[model samples]
Every structure is written in C-alpha cells, then in structure tokens.
Target: MGPSVAKLASHDRVWQSIRQSAAAMVAEEPILASLVHASVLNQLHFEDALNYILAQCLGTAEAPAILLHQSFDELTTAHPDVGAAARADLAAVCERDPACRSPLEALLFFKGYHAIQTYRLAHALLNKGRRPLALHLQNRMALTFGVDINPAARLGRGIMIDHGTGVVIGETAVVEDGVSILQGVTLGGTGKDEGDRHPKIRRGVMIGAGACILGNIEIGARAKIGAGSVVLQNIPPGCTAAGVPARIIGRCANTEPARDMDQGFDDVEA
Candidate 1:
C-alpha cells in the first residue's frame, strides 16, 4: 500500500473516545452542537474529520478552505504515518496537560496540538518535493498560531507543546519522540550558519517555557531544562539544566521528565 489505506485499527480506540467526548461536549454546551458535529461526528473517518478541521482553520483567501481541505486529505491518504503521528500527539497532550479536559478538546481547541499536526502535514509535503506548498502551510501556521516550525525540521511522535505560543524551532532542528516543550521555547541557531545548525533534542526531554537552546548542540535524552534559561552547551542525559547559560543543576528526579511533566526544582541546586 502506498499511503492511502486507512490506518483505522491503530486509531480506532482513540477515535471512538474522541467521538464520545465530542458528543458529550455537544450535550453539555448545546450552542456548540453544530460545530462539534461538523468537526467530528459528521465525518466518515478520523483523518477526514482532522483534515476538514485544519483546512477550515488555516485556509485563507489565498488558500481556499476547500482546496486546503482536499490537499490535506490527499496528504493523509498518501501517509498513514501522518495520521499515526497525529494520534500519538493527541494522546500526548491529553496525557501530559492537566488543563486538557478531553481528547476532543485537544483535537478541536488546542493550538499546540493544531500546530504540531499542521507541521506534520507540512513536513510530509516537503519530503515529497512540494516545497512551495509546504512553506505556505508553515507560513500560515506561524501567522495563525504564533508557533514557527520550519517544514525541513524533523520531529518524532508523542510531542507535547504546551501553550504553543512563541515556540520557534529552526530548520535543521531535530526533536525525538516524547519531548515536551513549553511556551516561548526556541530551538534555534546563534550565529550565521549554513547546514544543520539547530539543536538536536533527544527523546523524553522536557524543555521549559522561554528556554532558548541555540547552536548545533545535542540535548541528551530525558533531560529537563528550566524555564527562561538559555541553553548554550550540550546537556548530559537524565540531568536538569537551569539558569541563564544553563548549568547542570542536578540529575532529573526521575528518568521520564517529559512524561512526568514535573517542574519541581526542589531537589536541584540553583
């Protein structure tokens, strides 16, 4: 199978849960019933519903909603992995964010989830040599969500970007699976660079809000970065870095900082 076959088996359970949640929301807030139906219930499949929702959100006069919707549907049809990644991301949000009430809330209302999903779509298109369209989607996403992630950047599944506003990931940045990044974070470059300039974020890393990790550095796996710090050097695995020009304050209290979502720096030395 090329990329069109439905990956229903993998997403079935979550899709059903999301549908139930959406229906519950409609019942609770009767005013939003029509929107909830159009966003989830009316669609034939999960991917179809997602495509329609994002297209309506990012579509503009230059990029009509119908056209954008069809293109996103085609992308998902050609890439079942895209749908799979989106499912993982949705779950990541629901699991990690306390404020996230339901999977339907993550699917319909969260800009962080929306940005990541759209970035996945753009990344898939970029790999197919559709640079122009990929760039266009990235531009629209940045403008709409205040999160700017280049299409060329490589990101893995189960990414949770909490309060995604002002999240800027550079072109060559690489974020591995199960990474939780907060608002105002910047995975960027420090100086004039050519190729592979951005930071390489390892798996299970939790970067706090407004932390800037600049240059071609590697943030080791399961490391936690404190809020508002500037990460200039390579951080070791299972460590916690904080302060301006972040220092290794101490080891992560637990191995899975990303999954734990713990901001308690009580054990770490300032």
Candidate 2:
C-alpha cells in the first residue's frame, strides 16, 4: 500500500507483538503481573504506555508521577515523531541485540532504550526553547540510568546503545542512523575548546564498550571501533580501529558492523 498505511501496519504489528509478550510474561511469572499490566497491558496506545513508564521512572517527590505523566503525554501528542523514532529504536534493539528477545523487554526493561527515548523528548523540548526542562530531563537520565547524552546532541533514528550504563555523549556530537554504541563509551571533546568540538559518527557504525573517541573526528560509515580504544583522529569507511591511541587496525569482515553486532577485533588491512 502507501507509505502512511505501511507505517501504520508496522506500528500495529509491533504493538500487538509487544502486548502478546507482556501477556505471556504475566502468565509465566505471576509475581510481575502488576508491573506488566501497568507498563504494557493497561494502556490502549503504545505511546501512552511508554509515557506512563517514563513518567513513573523519572518522577520524584518534588515532581509527582501524575504531573510528569501528563507532561510526557502532551509532549508526545504534540510531536509524534519522537514516538516514531522510539519505535525505530525498539526495532534496532530487537534486530541487533541478541539479548532483546521481545519489544516488551526493550520497552519495559532496557535502560538503554529508556535513555534514548528520554533524550529524544528532551531534544525536542530543547529545540522548542525549553532549555531548563530539557536540562532537567538530561540530569534525571544521567542520575537514574547512568547514561548522559546532551539534549543538544544530534542523534538520528535507529540507534541502539547496548548496556547503556556509563555512556556519555558530548553536546556537539552527531550520531547518525543505525549506530550501535556499547556501554562506557565516551564521545567527548579533547580539550576545553568550545564550538563544534565533538565526534561525528556516520551510519551503521559499531563502537565497542569503553571506547573513548575524543576530539572532533569523523568516524566513517560502517566503521568498527574496538573496545577500550582511545581514538584521536578520523577513520575511513568500512575500517576497524583499536589501540591505546587507536590506529586503523584493519578492514571489517561485515559490511554493516552495527547491524551485525560483531565485536571481533580482527586483523586485515585498512
């Protein structure tokens, strides 16, 4: 059919599958029945359930859960693309992460998913000139999920931040679509120099855990960054880099390393 119709069909399928998974969870582990129902089964729309979950997770004594729930609902209703990007992100996790068996798991359990969706909302707010509120969201996400992504950062759709703890993305960093970033990864600047001082990650790149990619470098498309590497300069497309001061170690076996989710640091040639 048409694009809108196809999108609706896809959205329907994703929501239905997540609902079935949540139901199965309730039946199998009766202990989590309340949580499953509240998080997934109770809501009519997928976005509503997501908003409720985010509100509950981000709420505190000062800002009540009910108010935050209303606020998030308004935000997503005003800007539906945030929810759409969230669905794409959920699909990315399901397709790339072996541990993510169902969309229900990514929706209700994964903090990486939670952090990304929250950043999307905060980014939208930042664009709308709600700086204080956006910063509040950024602070909450950092404290609660241990994932600190600046709201000003430009992140494209279909991103999967696996095991999201200790991940820090700088304010000027730009992460393109279909990128997979592991835990403890830092996309920070090298020095105190202001204005556009962060890495620009291209599409389908996979950055391993604890990889510190510092400075205003261009990480080319489908690049594979080895774990714990200290990258200082630009990397060409389809290449792998790894070391204390990471150099071009080799070329990747897989064309789409992010989608492939391969963590192998092989030796071939750039």
Candidate 3:
C-alpha cells in the first residue's frame, strides 16, 4: 500500500482495536461502562479520542477542556505527523512493554504515552513560534504527568518511555527514532551551557532506568546504557556503557537495544 493509505489503515486498525477493548471492558466491569464509552467508544477517530483524554487529563482552570480539545484538534489537523508519531509510539509500547497487552492499554492507561503525545502538540506550537502556548502546555504536562520534555526538543517516531515519571529531556535534546528510555532518565546538560546543550541520542538506543546522560554528547546508534549509570562522554555505536561516569564496557548484545529491552550487563566494571 501507498504511504498515506498505509498510515490511514494503521490508524483505522488501532481505532478498531481500541473500540473492541472498550467493549470488552464494559462487559467485564459494568461500573466502568460509562467511563469506557465516554473515553473511547463515543469518539469517532483515534485522534479524537486521544484529544478528549489528553484534554481531560491536562486541562486546567486557566485552559479548560473544551479549549484544549479544540487546540489539539487544530494542531493534529494542521500537522498529521503528530497523529502518525502517536500511532508509532503506541505500537512501540505494545511491542516493548511487557505489561502492555494491547494498544488500547497504552492509549488509555500509559502516562508515558500520553506525555509524549502532549509533547508532540507542544513541539508543534513551539515550531510555529507560539512559545507562550507551547510553554503553557509543557507546564501542564509536567504537572499532570510528571514528565518534563522541553517543547523545543526534537523527538522522532517509535519512541518508548516506560513508567515515564521523573523523565526529563532538556531543550535541544535530539532523540532519534526507535529509542527506548526508562523511568527517571535525564537528557540534560552538565552545566549552564547554552546552544545545543543536551545530548543527541541516535536511533535504536536503549537508556535504562534512573540513568543520567548529561551534556551535548552523541550516543551512537544501538548503544545500551545500563540502569542508574551517569553518562558523561560520547559512546560509540554498537557498544554498551554502564556505571557512574559511564564507561564503555563492551559491545551491545543486540543490534537494536531499544527493541530488545535487555538491561543486563555481563562485562560491566566495578
């Protein structure tokens, strides 16, 4: 199928799956029937349902739900890639997260997924020079989801952020496609340096939980960073880095560490 048609079909499949899951949820838990209908069954498309849920979660007294919904809808319509990236993220979570049973679970329950989608909208606004609105959304996301990603950061598709709480990505951080970042990870600068201070995480890199990657370093594609490690230097492609002031331990066991989700380190130094 053509690219556009394929994307549409992918969205349709996800919407159908969500509807089926919502129906099953209503059948299993009668108490949640109304909630399921309002959240998923009543919505027309995937983006519509997403907008509704995000608005409900992130909207505040200053920016009400209806207004946030309208803004999100406009952004999604203006830039269709936001929806595409969201779908890819859903697929990534379903594939990588062991707790995720289906795309519906990621859509309805995963705060990480929700945070990324919200960031996508904020990033779009930032690109359009709507800095105030973008910053507003960023603040709301941090307040609501505990995930703080700067609106100016560049994130690619197929990203998986597991247990997204306390995850912070600084401004000018460039996370390439197919990167998997776990909880409590920081992609920040070492000091108060300005202009492209954050790290550039290449494609298919897996960063473990509680790991801190600071400064404007380039983490090569398919490299693995062990949990709780403090990364300070550039890591070459296909290698694994671990421990405080993370050093290159050995080659990555898998070519796509992000997809593998393997955090084990055999040759890590003390």
Candidate 2, superposed: residue stretches over 4 Å from native: 1-11, 267-270
Per-candidate TM-score against the hidden true structure: 0.94, 0.94, 0.94
Clashes of 2: 0
Residues 135-207, candidate 3, lDDT per residue (tens digit)? Answer: 9989999998999999999999999999999999999999999999999999999898889899999999999
Backbone clashes per model, in order? 2, 0, 0
Cα lDDT of model 1 by residue, 1-270, tens digit = 112323442357777777778778888999999999888877767788889989988999988989999999999999999999998998899899999988889889999999999999999999999999999999999998889999999999999999999999999999999999999999999999899899999999999999999999999999999999999999999899999979999888788899888876875533
Clashing pairs in 1: 3-77, 3-78
lDDT of 3: 0.91
Error of 1 at 67 (Å): 0.6
Which 10-residue window of candidate 1 scores lowest in summed lDDT? 1-10
Write down the worst ten-residue block by lDDT for model 3: 1-10
Q: What TM-score does model 2 achieve against the real structure?
A: 0.94
State residue 198's C-alpha deviation in candidate 2, in Å. 0.7
